[model samples]
Target: MASLSLRQVIKRYRTGKTELQVIHGVNAEIADGEFVVIVGPSGCGKSTLLRMVAGLEEISGGEIAIGPRVVNQLEPAERDIAMVFQNYALYPHMSVFDNMAYGLKIAKVPKDEIRTRVDKAAKILELGHLLERKPRELSGGQRQRVAMGRAIVRQPQIFLFDEPLSNLDAKLRAQTRLEIQKLHRELGITSLFVTHDQVEAMTLAQRMIVMNAGHMEQFGTPEEVYNRPATTFVASFIGSPPMNLLHHAPGNRPGQILGIRPEHLDVASDGWPVQVETVELLGAERLVHARLGDEALIVRLHEGEGAPAVGSTLTVRPRQDRLHAFDATTGQRL
Candidate 1:
């Protein structure tokens, strides 16, 4: 396990006389054996940053260091990193054991050593019983595990996951997520997982990097980013259903955008008057979609709490300390 560092990393694409910069001077330091997730919406440069670190994409400026060595100019094989791609990248004709041992074979590792490493990885990934099956004979989750097993056997310094759960069903994704968490705990490998899903980011990350529009929005522990977002983009992007941003919201300073999460808004007697537009019952809780003048807001109501019917009027007040204020022009947190 080793620490990963990104210092003022930049990426650009040149088309004729024009240069389009995609990653803008991003900086982050990931501790050894920590699980760090890079999350954002599509086209936000999250994957680009990951590829850069994997030595697939060239950095336009600055440095990327894996452990003690700067890996910017090194080949992907020389980086001492293992990348598990989204597609599972397993060979259809190869057995699970062969798939896991392929890399070691390519590196000319001795046969007995490769067998020991593959057996250990198979045991770790719970693929020991299925080692004789080909990729076609295995289930999706099993194949994904085989992919992970291939990476695990290498015992690289860092593990890179590029949305490894995207192709699985909801239940499988959840189950595999737990498996990955357990794998991390048992192996204690340094990992950098890139995903656009906030749920994955919140659940899997010890710390996370939030990116938007070619720039890093915030980098912090999940608790810090969730409880106190550093920017409006972070506030809006990191949460489920996202934070509501209202211009000139009640009790907000002039020229500032008021931000509040649905769960933080409470039913109050003297609060912002809202006209209920829709209500969605989500088993344990209900989401109340309402209008406050021209702005739309969502309030989360727990079970046992009375829910407002559509076309009805109610008042929802944001908790004082839970409220977030951001600059109207720049969207930076205030």
Candidate 2:
């Protein structure tokens, strides 16, 4: 495995005289064996950036290097990277064993070596019993594992995953995530995973890159990104209920916005009065949607706490230390 580096990476699409720039100057230094995830909204250029690193898309400006070599002009095959696509590109006629062994076969590896590598990868992915099965006979999760096993047999310097869990059911997605974590632990390959799901990003990433409209918003561990978001876009995008940004929050200074998480606010008798608009019960916790002046905010109540009635006025207090402040004009954290 080798470290990956992106130095002022840029991408642009040209049609006649019209030019559209999609990726800005993105720079990152991903250490060897680190599982870094690129996450953002659908059109945020997360995939574009990943594609650039994979040598699938050409970089319009700047440089990309894997280990010590600059791979700006290298083909995908020459980049020493294996990609696991979302669709699980597999040969219908090939069995699990053949599918995993195809790459080694094409490279003219000896028959015994190919078998050994395929068997090793199958064992790692728990596919030893399914070696003779075809892609059509396997479950969706199984097929994805086959795809991963194929990448494993090649033992590339890096692994690139393009939303490999998007096609699975919720339960299967959760199970596959655990399998991937285990696989990473065993193989320890440098991986770059791209996805639009925040939960996947939070669970699978060692360090995550938060992208927004072609810009690299933030790059850090999940805890750092969730606790101390660098920008308002990150603060609003990373969480489930999302952080509340109050432009006209009580006691806020001019040109500043107050930010607080739903779980950081508590129901109190002497604080900001808000009228309950709606309440949602989610298993172990309750979400109270309320209107404070003209602004809307959500407050989370844990189990054992009584849910406030709708249309009732209640005061909620924000934890002083948990509060966040941002610039109104720039939408940047202060």
Candidate 3:
């Protein structure tokens, strides 16, 4: 395992007349064996950053270090890192064992060592039973396991995953997430995963880097990002149903935007009057869709709490200490 560091990393592309910058002065330090997720919406440059670290893309400026050595000019193969791509990319004719062993073969590892490595990786990934089977014979999840098996056999210092689960169905994605967590615990390889899914970032990351418009919006534990978002973009992007950003809220000070989460707002006898528009009964909770004055808001209700009738007037109060205040103009937390 190896610690990874990026100092003021930048990526830019030349357009017809002007330069277009995609990643801007990003810096981060990932501890050895840590699982860090780089998350953002599509077109936010998360994949570009991951590519830079994997040495698949050239760095426009600054430095990238894997463990003790700087790797800015190193080729992808020389970086001692393994990348699992979105596509499984398994050779259809090759059996699982052959596909997993091909890299070592190309590197001229001894035949016995190749067998030992392939068998061990297959066992770890639960692909032992499918060793002789071709990629065409395996299920999507099984084929994905084969792709991972190829990476595990490399025994690289770092593991880079570029939205590896995006191809799986919802159920498979959830199952594979558990598999990945288990793999990390057992092997303890340093990993960087890139995704646009906030739930994946929240559940899988030891720490998360939230990105927007190529800028590093926030980098911290999931709890920190969810509970005390650093900016309005982070606040709005990290949560389901998102936090409410009110410009004309009762408690909002002049030139400040009031922020509150759905769960932090409760039905109160005397509070902000909200006219109910709709209600959605989620399995374990409920989402109340209402309008506070003219602005729409959503409130989360726990199980057994009755939802108010549509078109009815209801009062909701925010937990004072839980409220977030941001600069209205800059959207920075205040």
Candidate 4:
């Protein structure tokens, strides 16, 4: 395992005559044995940053270090980092055992050591039973596990995951996410995971780095990123229904753009007057869509409780201490 440090990292693509900057001076310090997630929308440069760290992409400026070595000019193989991609890049003809053994074989490790390493990784990934099966024979989850097993077998200094769970179905993704967390606990490798899914980032990451327009919006734990977002973008990106951000001027009155989370807002019997527009009953909770003047406010109430009828007026209020204040001009947290 290794600690990764990125200092003023940048990436640019030269088209015909235009120099497009994909990443702009990214800086992060990932400690050894830490699981950090890079999360942002498509074109936000999260994947670009991770690829740069993996030595798969060139860094236009600055430097990246894995442990004591500056790996900016190093080849991917020289960096001693194992990367798992979104597509399970398993060899079609190769059985799972051979696939896991390929890296050690290419590295010229002895045959017996390769067998020992492959056997260990397969057990860790619960792929021992499927080692003799080809890629086509395994289901999607098993294939994904094989991809991870291949990486784990090498026991590299750092692990890089680029949306590895995106290909799986919802249920499988959830199960595999737990497996990943457990694997990280057992292996204790420094891992940098890139994904746009907030749920995945929240569940898998010890810390999350939120990026926007090639710049880091925030870097902190999932709870810190969720509860105390540095900007409106972080606030909007981290939650399920997302934080309800109303556009209003800063003041103690109704002018302040009140940031209330859906879970925080309760459907009380008495509060400010608002018209209930719709009611959606989820398994354990009811989502009440209401209109606070022109702003759309959603309130969550207990399931099995009768919601107010459509067009029915009810009072709703935001908890004062729970309100997050952002600057009017820049949308930064105040």
Model 1 segments beyond 4 Å from truth? Answer: none
Clashing pairs in 3: none
TM-score of 3: 0.98
- Runs off by more than 4 Å, candidate 2: none
Q: Each model's TM-score, in the order given?
A: 0.98, 0.99, 0.98, 0.96
Is candidate 3 or 4 superior in TM-score? Answer: 3
Candidate 3: stretches off by over 4 Å: none
Between prediction 1 and prediction 4, which has the larger TM-score?
1
lDDT of 3 by residue, 12-109 (tens): 99888899999999999999999999999999999999999999889999999999999999999999999999999999999999999999999999
Instruction: Please report, in order, the local distance difference test score of every candidate based on alpha carbons.
Output: 0.94, 0.96, 0.94, 0.89
User: What's the lDDT of the predicted structure labeled candidate 3?
Assistant: 0.94
Pick out the ten consecutive residues of candidate 3 with the lowest summed lDDT.
Answer: 244-253
Highest lDDT model number = 2
Model 3 lDDT at residue 265? 95
Order by lDDT, highest first: 2, 3, 1, 4
